[model samples]
Target: MQATGSSHSLALRRGDFTTLIEALDYAAKGDTGVNFYNARGELYATSTYADLQVEVVALARRLLGLGLEPGARVGLVAETSPHFVRFFWACQYAGLVPVPLPATMHIGGHAGYVAQLRGLIENCGAAVAMAPVEWMSFLEEATTGLTLSFVGTPEDFDRLTPSTATLPTVAPDSIAYLQYTSGSTRFPRGVVIDHTTVLANINDMASHGLKMTEQDRFGSWLPFYHDMGLVAFIMMPMATQRSVDFLGTQDFAMRPRKWLEMMSGNRTTITSGPPFGYDLAAMRVRPSDAEQWDLSALRVACVGAEMINPEPLKRFAEALAPSGFKSTAFLPCYGMAECSLGISFAGLDEELQIDYVDAEQMQEDSIATPLDPEEAQKSKRRVARYVDCGALLPTFEIAIRDEHGNDLPERQAGVIHLRGPSVMSHYFQEEAITRECLSEDGWLDTGDIGYLANGRLFVTGRRKDMIIIHGRNIWPEDLEYLAKTQPGVNYTDAAAFSVPSDVDQQETAVLVVQCRERDEIKRARLVKTIASLVRSEFGIDVVVELVPTRTLPRTSSGKLARARARLDYLGRRQAAKMQHQPEPANSLPMDEAMPQVRYIA
Candidate 1:
């Protein structure tokens, strides 16, 4: 299959349309469209915008034949294939709200994945659902007990007779899709983003975030379920009449180098991923491989979806530097699904910026004071490093507020709140949660803790993840950092949180590090070393536990789920006591007293 050209002769638009249907109508005039690639960096499928419009409209007619009501929900298993793209756009033409379910199934976790799918399907109240052949069994099982008008795969839907009825007129206020957040979730809620809200965010992203031009093409391996994948790669490119190359998320995970290959081969100017993607790709790339590729055309390599770790990004840039991957192309951004994906972005053609704050003052007073360079050189232990996520778009109004809801000044770390056209009006059918997260006026409590420094946003951590010990604020990321610094430890291997203490009105800090060492002596040494570092750094004793790798739970989008970790820890602790069995050696302090260190191997 031949991929679409990067440069097209048709006029380009910058996501200025109010509805997705309108945007698609305009883009159908252009030759630029989405291209899909297989695991080996080979193009497998290509659909020009004009062809995509015809396919989706035909699919929409068949979907209308199902006799479902307008504004009905259609569940879709979001595999990174042409089927998913066709179905997503078909819903837009049919005037039905599409909800993209996760395509990933964790190793040896079938029951868990099914339950998660069931919860999402139930929550969304989907009237019809579709999945690819490989994922059909899971979708069938998930919807077994539910009442739905129709359920099938793309092939099955195609067999349905096309309706003679005309397609309904989609309003700007109509819901485009329900993006289920892949953040911390016992059960995830769908973020309801209307056509106007999503398009506004896309406009802000193109006009300000990436400064998209007609010359810019896109490439990504982020899954369709992810906001970055859906909006940035899917919507943004088509809105501007730019072609995009897509590598499946699972395929990219199996062959990380293929992502870099796709970028170089396509001469794509923009791509984005979390820090882990860079880390994985850098680990797999060779200097010789970089020397072979022509990557000078690639400019914006956006990083977001998780906290930006400068070290991994630095390594990625260095590894690909031989291929003309400039360090200035690394763009750190801050966004969430609730806000339609993109709040702030670093300056174009700027190097990644870091703000080293005094860790002590940040913990005690919640202030992000820049550390003195001379003092930092003398004793760097007091510094906390955070990447600058840059300025918010002109559309957003941000405020930093304390626990009491009093707005704080710049440089003061507090809950980050935002109000903008991009912000979602509510969670799907979750009015109680919507009320808790959003105010009556407009502001949405983002549940993130950060500070604005000189108009730039520096995200510290999540508000709910904060631990208070001896009336001093404790950030779990700091404790995790101490563990990550240890040898044989990598990023995403440590989880830190506070457990309820035996003492009155106090909590004990705990750090769980995923250790790979099998030797008893080495494991013990690693735990003790991490525990001692916590003592010296925070003046608080922490119980350090070492567990097997991949034991730490993460959200679907690859963010560490610390709250779930704590719950699992407490559950195991209770189970041990009930079985009348002793806990792991040094799993707890010698006594219930304070300032006592314990190490678990």
Candidate 2:
């Protein structure tokens, strides 16, 4: 199948419409649309914006014919296919809130996937649920104990009769979608986003973050369930009337090269992912492949979702330099689902900037004192680096507050607070959790610890994941980075947190490294080597534990689930306490497994 053309006859728009249906109406007037690439980097499906508009409206009529309420929730298994895109827009036209459930599946972890799906199904109180043909059995299994009006595939939904009733009027205040957080728990919290909120974010992003042009076409392997994927690639492109290309998230993981191939062959100008995605792509790309790929038109490589790592980005640029990839195209951005996707984004076409600061003063006094890299090397004090996440959108109001909620001055590290049009008002059916983060006067406690310098946001660490010992705060990313520097340790292999030890009730920092080595001696040495490095670097003793590869749990969006890992550590210790009782000869080991990674917990 031929993909959509890069240039369209229709005039370009920058997310100026009031609702998604309105935006789709405008985009459908153009020839630009979305293209889906298979695992082999070949285009398999193509849908022009006009075709999408006509098809979804019909699907909307069919859905409304089911006699479901206007505001009924539709649980959709997002698998990066045309079906998901169709169903998502159909719900929008039908005035139904489409909840994109994760299509991610762990190898041989069916039970966990079922539990997660069941929890989400019940959490959102879905009126209807649909899955792809290949995933139908799992969906049936997950919905076994739940009650829903309908549970079937897209074809099944299509088999229904069309309604004679007119579709509901699309409103700006109406719920557009329910975006679920990739939490560490079985039940993920859904962030409620309306038409106004989402459009405001999209407008700001297109005008500022991307600085999109008519020639710009987007490409990504990010899952549809992810904010960056759903908002940036799909919605942003459609809203701006630009064509976009997509490769499955699983396809990219298995063959990261396909993403590059598609981008180069299609001349995609915009794409994004977390740091690990770039690292994975760099690892998989060979020198010969780079020579054959022509990526001269590729631009705007946005990075966020976690701490920015310059090393992998640099490697990716260097490897693809022959293919015409420029390092300055890397735009470091910061955002969350709570903000409708974008909060702050770096300047377009600019190099990703880093700020080096005195780690000691910052950790102790909550002050971000600037320090030169050379001075840091000479001085005995530790140094920390934070990427410049650019300035907040013009529509946002930002503040930095200390632990006691007192306002902090510039460069003072504290909890970042924001009030913006796109900020989510509440979590679906989660009032208490909503109040914990969002305040009364419209300010949202982002739960991210960061400081502002010259109006730009530089995120340090997550407030909830901050490791404190003896009144000193430590960024877990710092410890994890150090552990990853060791030999045989790949990126995302280390998870660091504070835990209570056997000797004392107070918390001590622990770094859990996923070691693939089976030899006890090598494993011990790897553990000890990291332990010594941490002690010398921070002047504090840090416990190091080596677990099997893939032991660390990851969120659905492919982020390391540190929160879940911490719970596993606690559960393992609790199990060890019970194991302290006299045991049999062939009993299993305590340190070998984790909670949902399922043994020690």
Candidate 3:
């Protein structure tokens, strides 16, 4: 199948418009738009700018006919399909706020998924909710008791009559969409972004971050519910009138090789995914397939969404080297939903840069003291490596602040604060949360621990996920990484956090590992090996528990929800204690007793 471009090419327009409607209107005059592919790398559908304009306008009229007021929230279950794209733009043209809800449902997580959708529907006070035909039942079940104006499939919404009423005029400051945080689905907060705010971010990302050009073609398997997927792949490409190719998130998960195959065939210039995506693809690559395709056209493989693990990326770059893939193409970036997608990006055409700092000093004094190469090689000190996330984007200000809200000096780890035009105005309808995160002076507390050295931002860990033990700071990721290095431990199969210490009131590290071995002896041995590895690596005693595969919870975007896992573990421990039952030694069920063994050095 052909790539996403029309026969008649038009000159590229790089952020010349103010609003999304205006941007689409200008893009319709050209030929570039969006294209979709299946798991087998076959094209399913293509929507040009001209085709979108016609359908969006027609759908907008029908949506306004529903008698919903301007600025009303329209909840759209964000499936990776053309319907979501149409409905999203329809809301923009009709002056309504579109709330993209997560469409991914985990196995045995139907009830939790329904509850999450219901909470978002109630929280946004959505006037209407629309899902694809396959997901209509879940949406209906989610809104059973809610007072929504309408709830059905996109086909149902399309069957509405057109209204003669004039559409409301959209302003720059008007709400573009409500982006819910990927963290904490139980209490999701919708970030309020205006047309101008998103446009500013898109402009900066396209012009400065990716350095977009007419020849640049975007491709991805990122879900539309995510800010990186929605803003970077969908909105940014449309704003620049550049063609983009999409593979369904599930399809990519099942067949990651198809993503690279399509990119190679289409000569895709830019694509982005979390580090896990690259790691999975690297694991599936064969030596013979290297000669089957060319990947030299891939200039920017933007990596974000979760912790930036350099090992997997290095493996991917090495495996694809014969196919002309450059390791320097990996653009490590730092961003959140609150910032409209991007905060800082690594320099273009540069290899990944990592700073090796004294780990003990960083944990105790919060000082990121860089280690000399010779000293790092000879010294017996523990060192932590943090990826350089590059400089902040132009027009953005980043300050590393202490607990007292004072700015910290360079090389000192502190809370990351941001001030920029693209920052969200507030959390929709959540005044208390909005006030807690955003200051009156327009600075936002990012809730991430990081240090700035020579203008580069180095993310250390999450503020809430930090573990303090014996006046020492331990990042969960550090422990998790060590656990994953053990034999039989897979990437993302382990979660590390702190629970109440059995000997003292201090917090103790706990590592929950998912094991496929059902044999009690083997599972117990695996747990022991992991505990030993953690103790040897970090010099800390840990409680290791093995659970059935896929027992650990993940966020909608597939990020390990460590905080939630800790809570679930504690709840199960409490329930088991109250039941007076013997703890299972191997393959413990999530709802049952959690068998814990503390390994003391």
- The CA lDDT of each predicted structure is 0.88, 0.87, 0.86
- True-vs-predicted CA distance for residue 177, candidate 2, Å: 0.3
Question: How do the residues 175-257 of candidate 2 rate in per-residue lDDT, one tens digit apiece?
Answer: 99999988764467899999999999999999987888889999999999888888888788999999999999999999999
The residue-by-residue lDDT of candidate 3 on 523-591, one tens digit each, is 667777777877776777888877666778887778888888898788767777798865554333333
TM per model?
0.96, 0.96, 0.96
Question: Model 1, 1-601: lDDT tens per residue?
Answer: 7899998787767899979999999999988899999998899999999999999999999999999899999999999999999999999999999999998875238888888889999999999999999999999999998999899989999999999998999999999999998756347889999999999999999999989888999999999998888888888888888999999999998999999999998998999999888998998999999999878888899999446788889999999999999999989999999999999999999988889888889988998889866688698548888999999999999999999999999999989999999999899998999999899989999999999999999998887789889999998888998899998998878999988874573799989877776666777788878888888888898878776666788777777888888886777667666877654563433222321223542
Candidate 2 TM-score versus the reference = 0.96
Global CA lDDT computed for model 3 = 0.86
Better of 1 and 2 by lDDT: 1
Error (Å) of candidate 2 at residue 561 is 0.9
Model 1 TM-score, all chains together: 0.96
Better of 2 and 3 by lDDT: 2
